[model samples]
Target: MDILHTLNIASSMTATVFRGGAGIATHPAGAQPEMLLELYDFEGCPHCRLVREVLTELDLDARIYPCPKGGKLFRAKVLELGGKTQFPFLVDANTRTQMYEAADIIRYLYSTYAARQRPWYWRIIEIQRLLSIIAGLPRLGSGSRARPRSAGPPAHPLELYSFEANPFARPVRDVLCVLELPYILRSTGCPAWGASATDPAPGSRNRARLQARAGEISIPYLIDPNTSTQMKESADIIRYLLRTYGQTENGQTKK
Candidate 1:
């Protein structure tokens, strides 16, 4: 299992390389919005991946609504509002603006949060989209489709501290996607010890908070306020998700 996990993440890392560091660190969103941003996306979609990358890079937090293929939860809601079933649709409550298309969402994020123009690479639109498709190839649709499960919504949005390309973090995001669970994605694109004036911190509490819980700061740290659990290590986190949410690690559904 460990070897397979390593191989899985290695390919995810390779996909990150292909993305050219889009979600690697914080870029200091200009005048943060009071309302949390919302994203309707599935984990394995290349188009959705680009929008998520920018969210991490800008160090912005969002309420993620996973709309995996064939998922009944949020797909209908998206279609009702947007008039189509599209992944990576963004809704900004702060501005009451909603739109589709990866490139457009990226531009909106930069304009609204980063207060800058979209990067040049994004200008080449076609190439960027192609690379995103390639990135999803390795994960093989782990978060691309929904699965059978029984559960009720959490009282609060689960928070995840993850950088877009963290191989370890990808699996957690996948499970969250599969369950259609909403989460606040807190990105550590530029580590605290490495942040710049332009690149702000992911969050102040993340470092100290993880240290207190995991004995050291780490990526893929999960904070499930509903369960009052904070921990690291991907496999353990997956198991906890199953148990806390009522299921088994072997993929058996619980009633």
Candidate 2:
């Protein structure tokens, strides 16, 4: 792996550790919404991170619309839809529910889908905010700001199999956010690390499908139908995205 990319992964690992691996496990949701869930959030926001972890824990997939700061894309859409600018807004068309505030969102998700009371730890939103902010420090400012998009969005939303707090997955998500790419987040959360590929949670449908399709359960796996590319490994994915979307028509790479 490239040394800087290795360091980026290491920093992400530290962030995951600081958050206590909140998104590491999959809990069976009471029901999957008939309609897709929509999440409006940026990658680096602490509150957004919390909401994402819960989504993973519940093993729910959602359509992710990245709203990175200074982004001209979905940021405006969120304001128009919600009547205000919020970092982590959720819209469940299934229930005609639209709301903001990470704490409230977490509660709504648990009550609506999981049909279980929030765990004691998850209930402590204050502590969660502190820890998540601290967790974000290692890669502060990244995935928070938008980079200019040289290319328009894909014909179809990309698909990514990942869980929140995954060291290898975080970087890929960051790039997607920066480029303002919408995607289907396939929540492949496992009960534990090191066992995710060899042995996943018994109820993890995403994991089983991933294993059968990819021939393994290794994560941060990306499928870009627009380009007909399915790939693994964060480094390669990042390079591919930058090359495809972060470059000028004249073939100049843009930061």
Candidate 3:
């Protein structure tokens, strides 16, 4: 990564630390998914960040539909389904529940999937929300703009193995959100083994191992099952998405 990019990521990580890692801890409850939970949210929204952190803490995974501001797609779907543009909306296929607001969603996730006892720290939802907003200020207006192209939809939903706070992965998530593509978000959290001096960071070694299992050592790795394509690097992923799914200059498919 270039120095600037590295600094940007480091800055984001610093923000999470300042916020006391509010949304980063795992729940005593374990992973349990009969059918994937679905979330309609943008990457940079503070409200959305709260719910995502809970998902990571709970060690659960979900199908994410990126709903960036002014996104032509998915935003309409949210209004059609939920009657408003408010975000951090969640849908649980297992119970057939749909709702909005970050606090409500976090409570539901804990009640439905986690063990009975609630964490006292999470009771301060409003405080967390405010801090999340403060935390998001530096990365303002990112992952919120509409790009000027449209590629055709994929034959299958792509898969992204990532955690919410990875600086390298966040930009890729932003692009995917703006395009409103759905993907299986496999959360690769910290390693079962401890961190080391040679490691990229706390979870870097595990992320690399998981990527290697999928045939790589880098991230933000992407796998397009539709085209049998897989690659690493945020720039390449964005270029591929625009080339494949983004509209041509004439406002139609490239080909």
Candidate 4:
């Protein structure tokens, strides 16, 4: 990797540390929702990061609708659904519930799916939120706002195998968020404390699936069904996304 890219990954690692590695470990989930959960939030939102961490912890996959600031698309949908533009809005179609507030979302996910209560520190709402904000500072608002798109959204939602705190994965997610591309986030992380010591944790179904499908396990692995493309490497993914979807102000795809 180039020096600049290496530095970017280092900053992303710091974001994980600021949150004390919340998304690195997994917990058991009790029930699976019939339909995929939908999350309307920007990647750069501190509160959204908290919810994403819980998602990784519980290994729950969700369809992410990136609602970055100045985004013209999904932001309006959030307003129509929740009556305001406030985010980290979660729509659980199975339960017919749509709501905001990161703390409440974490509680609901744990209670409904994880079959347990949230971690103690997560219950300390204000303090946790404060720390999340600190964690997000290293990102320099990369995923907080929208960027131009060369074309409309793809017919099929892209698939991304990612864990919330994966430094290599974060930049890919940032580009997806900025372009407001909705994607199925397959939350993948270590199933236990030392799971990383093993190449693919025996307990990690996502990792197993990735290995079986791609012949290896690495993230953030992106599958763009729109173009029938699947690949690994964060920088390569970013470049492909820009070439395929991203646009400059003048409406040409960035090369």
Candidate 5:
């Protein structure tokens, strides 16, 4: 399918969810950490989506290990570390902390990294839960199934430039989740201010810089350092993943 078509589908899937990190609360000052935060989750999970939305609102970066159902690579890692398959599991190497549960994770993020005043929207935890579940309906079960084969894992984690509300990014993330490939999430949300100092629109400098570095502004962009392959478009990325990693000894995607 075309990129525009894919984006349209993604947008339709996440209609109720606010875009550009609206309504979510954020810290006035950025938090600097010694180590990158690690998360094990599937892109299609409502719970995981909540955490990622919060991450984007806070403008925090994370190392993601996709844990789609029937996945073999990171699923075992989640089991080893957390002793369960439950996700949105977070590990803070700097603080030596590992945690599960969406509500708890949200609270921890605010207290540890955000300003003292948390967003009122987040206070309505139940509402957030409901909305997240609603947002997840479009892509339900897309990332849960396992393929019959396996591609040997890469040496280094891949990198993805995306924001929570992006539809194209969602499908790419889903594929990664099912494949259990770990990656660095580079968020690219809209700017808070306009072009001028007095304007409120966020400037384009940051996004422009990222695009210049990557050679494109369109997201769900993937960079595989191990293979030195960087590309855009979700469908193409999915195809690449299947061709590279889909077949295992049993001729099935690893489950």
Candidate 6:
């Protein structure tokens, strides 16, 4: 990797420190959205980080639109729809509600989907904002700008099996953010706190589904139905996304 890219990945890894270790922990929501929730936010935004962290806490999947500053893809769309450009804008078709502000969005998700009040820790708006900002410090501007797109776009939204704080998974999400590609975030973080709990153990009650589908329990998996591809390793997944969607000289994909 180039110096800039290496620094970018290293910065992203440190971000996991402030994420409260929920990235790989999936505490299933009481109910999943009938339609996937749509979130418009960039990776490096502190406000956006709060919303995504809550998503994993609730085990809720969303179709994320990366609205990095100066991004041409989704930022404009958010402006036209919400009447102002904002970070962490949430569109919930289930309730026909589209709104901004990270705290309000977190409350809505927990109350509506989790069937409970928002967790006490995140109920403090100021605390959430402060921590999220600190979390964004390491990888400042990494995922807050749109990338150069040179290849054809995917026919459909991709699916990624990940949790927010997974160090290995952060780089993949960062790439998607810059590319402004939407995907369903399948969180596979374990619920328990023991050593073996990091993996999707049987006690989590979700591991069986993963084992049956993917043949083993592991995360940071990328399943691209657009190309009929599924992969587990983080490094390989990054390379695959870049090869398929990255800009190359002469407008041809890397091969």
- Superposition error at 41 for model 1 (Å): 0.3
Worst 10 residues of 2 by lDDT: 192-201
Cα error, residue 131 of model 3, in Å, equals 1.0
Worst 10 residues of 6 by lDDT: 197-206
What tens-digit string does per-residue lDDT give for candidate 4 at 1-255? 478778888889999889888887776477667899999999999999999988888888899999999998899999999999998999999999999999899999988997777779887989989999999898888899899898888999999999998999998999999999999998887777545523443345688788888888798999999999999999899889988999877888887
Q: For each predicted model, how many residue pairs clash, with residues at least 3 apart or on different chains?
A: 3, 0, 7, 0, 16, 4
lDDT of each: 0.78, 0.89, 0.73, 0.88, 0.70, 0.77
Candidate 5 residues 1-255, lDDT tens each?
Answer: 477556646664464354324423322224645688899888767788778877766666789988777777787887899899898899988888899998888888887876665578778878887877766666556766655546566789988877777666777777777777788887665555433322222432325656677765776788889778888877787777766666767677633
**Range of the 10 consecutive residues with the lowest summed lDDT in candidate 3:** 197-206
- Which portions of model 4 miss their true places by more than 4 Å? 194-202
**lDDT (Cα, tens digit) per residue for candidate 6, span 1-255:** 656657756776778777666445556677878888999998888888888888877777789888877777788889899999998999999899998999889888888887667767876879768877888888766777776676545788898877788777778888888877778777665674542542443223345556777888777788899889999877778788877887776766666
* TM-score, every prediction: 0.87, 0.93, 0.81, 0.94, 0.82, 0.88
Q: How well does model 5 score by local distance difference test?
A: 0.70
Q: For candidate 2, give the lDDT.
A: 0.89
lDDT of 3: 0.73
Clashing pairs in 3: 149-247, 150-245, 150-246, 150-247, 151-245, 151-246, 151-247
Ranking of all candidate structures by their TM-score, best first: 4, 2, 6, 1, 5, 3
- Please give, for residues 110-207, the per-residue lDDT of candidate 1 as tens digits: 88887677778778878878988877777777788876555666788888878787778988888888888888887655553454323224443344
Count steric clashes of candidate 3: 7
What's the CA error at residue 225 for candidate 1, in Å? 1.7
| lDDT of each residue in 155-175, candidate 2, tens digit only | 899999999978999999999
Total residue pair clashes for candidate 2: 0
In model 6, pairs of residues that clash are: 23-165, 24-189, 25-189, 26-189
